[model samples]
Target: MATKPKSPHQEQPKTAPPADEGRFRDDTDVAVDAIHQRIVGREQTEPEEGFEPPPVWVWAASVVLLFVMGFYLGRYSGSWSTVAHEVESPAAAAAGPVKRTVNGTVVFTGVCQTCHQADGNGVAGQYPPLAGSEWVTRDAATPIRIVLYGLEGPITVKQTAFNNKMTPFHDKLTDDEIAAVVTHIRSSWRNSASAVTAEEVADLRAKYGVRGSWSAAELSAERSAR
Candidate 1:
């Protein structure tokens, strides 16, 4: 005989309840609701403490601190002195009186200092020894041609050979400037030639207006021959 159909209760397999699923769902929903309430409450609350604004003095202090920092930074960066010097006018600047005699010395230092050192002893191979130079000792006119027309290529000074060239000063220097510089150079070294007068320089410049630098062949101990 067919066995009797199992009862629905017997047919259904016994299953254990899902552990913590319903409770977890309930707890999660509660926590979410609480968070939403907190958010809404925060939105409803008045803006907190009205941002206790800093005092006017504090703002002023901050501005002062920024200015001070910028000033010191500029000073340390070396831009301050440059900017300040640029901003100040030449007349307003702190300085001393410039000596007229120093002008000659300064010109010599700038132009002749390279060949003839500060002491006026020239380099052996590159430049002729200015000290005790016979050419410099000869006359004012000889040095004038040397300055105005310049010297070039294999010059013999006091039996010493100097092959280097000396640049012309006609265009670069004024007549007075040439006079002053030549006078200074001659007197400073072991040379004892008299000061080169501007009249002499002017005469030479007028005489040799467009001439190139003189070579040793072109130069002579006799100024009139040059």
Candidate 2:
């Protein structure tokens, strides 16, 4: 078969040119490079961690709290030498010792009651009676001497003989105590005599020094001499 020639005005069917593989590859590489650069640049310009000072209010509050604690401790804490529970006030320590009155009845009850009996009516034949006894009411010095140096050998009290020995109270009792006891005995029961003084007992104690028990004859001799 023979082919007819086309008209000059009629256009030939258009066809795409063959792809350039090298050029496409180069364009893909260029796009990837652009994306990578964008990511790297963003990372490089990003903000970094840094130290920041605390707020002014926080520092102020810490200082205020420390001052409050120090003030509280100073106000409440006692001196270093003082104990917590046994803390004594300065006023109490400055005061002098308390004055106490010595009771004669209490002294007699504790010391003399055991041997002399509470009624002053001593044991018959064993202890001499203080009730209406001539020896006790004779003179202040006689009884004082008997009490201070004690009595030995036989002695007549109320016309009755007492052979028992009497213990000395010079070392055991103070001058005031001895005086008070002697006064108590002299005024008690059926006896009525003058009250003994601490000065009298003290003088006798000083004069006699320390001696053994005195006998009735010796006591009589001394009384006669006096």
Candidate 3:
């Protein structure tokens, strides 16, 4: 059937029904209350989605990578060597035990240097000077005895008199420790003298048997006349 066309002046009858006020109202333009306003910008999206698990190819690649890494680490790790991470170092493997050496400088710095001073010139008037002192270079036995038993009462060092009491290290220090320290003090600070042997110190220590500390004169019992 032939239908007449509508004139442009006649507005088309509402094709879409007037937008429903409830459904089509602009929610963004709505004035939210204070309580809801806090969550206005932070609104939780509905039906939150999750990421997919890795594909089979990704799993396969990871397995291959881990296997290769494991093989590489097993070969190059050097876990079988004597020390950790000691690789193909032939010099390290062929090396023999090193001769144990005690640094006498270390011993002197730790113990005697406190009183004797780093320069071996002991505190004047308070402690006797070991540097170029007549008592230090007199003999091996004199120093060994002095250190083992300790010295007490007026002793002249470098022509200066010191009357302090030195604490005995006989009970505390080992034979090697005493020997190292004695040898160190003898040679240090230009105070040149023969090294005191540990064997000599041990002999004297065995003979002494917990006697009173030595007086400057009593050191002469074993001290070589110098």
State the lDDT of candidate 3 residue by residue for 1-226, as single tens digits: 2444343233222223355645653555444432343444333224333444658999999999999999999987777677755345677567855546677888788778889898877776788888898888977888888888888998777778789899888987888888888998888878789898789899999988898789988886566443
Clashes (backbone N, CA, C under 3 Å), per candidate, total: 0, 0, 0
TM values, all candidates? 0.53, 0.57, 0.57
- True-vs-predicted CA distance for residue 90, candidate 3, Å: 12
Rank order (by lDDT, best first): 2, 3, 1
- Residue range 4-59, candidate 2, lDDT tens digits: 43433333332333565444447886676556555443133234343456789999
lDDT of all predictions: 0.74, 0.77, 0.76
C-alpha RMSD values across all candidates? 19.7, 27.3, 14.7
**Model 2: per-residue Cα lDDT at residue 39:** 48
- Per residue, candidate 1 scores C-alpha lDDT tens digits across 1-226 of 2354333222222233477665544788667665655554313323333334578999999999999998889877765355553344686555645435436788888898898788776887778877888877677788788888788788788788889878888888988788898888788756777887788999988987788888766666345564
Return the clash pairs for model 1, or none: none
Candidate 3: regions farther than 4 A off: 1-99, 224-226
